[model samples]
Target: MNHVAPPGWPEQVRPPDAPEWERTAVGWLLDQCPPEYRGHTVLRRHPVALARLTAWHVEACQAGARRGLAEARTALRDALPMDAVEATIAALLTEQARLEGVRRAAGLVEVALRGRRFPARLPGLGSRHE
Candidate 1:
């Protein structure tokens, strides 16, 4: 049977049942991490480890976006025009939204790597990874 991807699965990752799915997962996860992460053989060899690392990296990025959103107005009040500060705030909000999706996708991959399976018709199930 073909694999059924859970909600919030990353488009770049093949379904778990696909041949070499782990390799695809590793590639997608590594893309989410720093360039140095690719140098670590352990992460490439272990999908779960790479998933964990990717999740952590995405979380850090989300936190940074949150901090930037919180301080943008005040931090830029003197140095930038009000419109520019508002634009910065908008940009930070957009980044936060994007990071949220990345976090969800990474979490789903991580759980899948850990042997969690999702049924095809999980009605009313939220996208939150277990």
Candidate 2:
């Protein structure tokens, strides 16, 4: 029998909409740090950067908010201590908040449709991830 690629293969492993789906250590960093810093270049190149990012991830997770790990992970972006993704794919793929950021991200996707440097952060979108 021939085997055809199934739909939702990767998503089945980790659905996108399942809040906290991408809230792991690195995921958290990707969500918080600037989009420019989301590449392997930083984590792969700089040991200090990787360590710092990892440390922050742990800190965000271990703070203890009564919410279950899954819940906390999901809401990691809702009230994160750090800033969230400013990129469109990153935002849409990650389901970001902040109307302005969303608008900017959408605009970015329109222009680049997959380009670099799309805000990654705005001025007024603050204090949500606390």
Candidate 3:
């Protein structure tokens, strides 16, 4: 059968033959992102928001100085008080945000290395080989 998205929704959002559980799981996953990335998590009420936000943050501090901070973020989710998954989707929208910076930086380094001007190609490799 052809896919019919939710009421008044755009075609792009049409589900991809997904089962209800799959959709629920995906929704749960998306909720974990920061406010901007996914949107507000606890939209129903203030208490729900605070509790969910707290559950999503072990220390409740702003993004940590370095990658180590993700551990805390992770801990918050992983160590839920009662295994509940509720959160906002504002994780990666602003210029200051970086959920995967290290990996991205590593990719940039790889690109730089690939573009480097080597004086001599190695013996078994390349344009400099005689």
Q: Evaluated with lDDT, which candidate comes out highest?
A: 1
TM-scores for all candidates: the values are 0.89, 0.22, 0.18
Candidate 2's residue-wise lDDT over 1-130, tens digit each?
Answer: 1111122122211222234322332343344444666667756344345436544543443332222323544555555643442232244434333323433322322232122222222435431111
- The residue-by-residue lDDT of candidate 1 on 1-130, one tens digit each, is 6476887888888877677778888998998899999999988888898899898899999999989988888889999999999989999998899899999989988998999877775546733222
Q: Model 2: number of clashes?
A: 6
| lDDT at residue 66 of model 1 (Cα atoms) | 89
Candidate 1 matches the true fold with a TM-score of: 0.89
Ranking by TM-score: 1, 2, 3
Off by over 4 Å in 3: 1-18, 39-130
- Comparing 1 with 3 on lDDT, the higher-scoring candidate is 1
Instruction: Pull out the clashing pairs in model 2.
Output: 20-74, 79-129, 79-130, 80-129, 81-129, 86-120
In the order shown, the candidates' Cα RMSDs to the true structure are: 3.5, 18.5, 18.8
Question: Order the candidates by lDDT, highest first — what do you get?
Answer: 1, 2, 3
Global lDDT of model 1: 0.85
Please give, for residues 68-88, the per-residue lDDT of candidate 3 as tens digits. Answer: 334435656666642332232
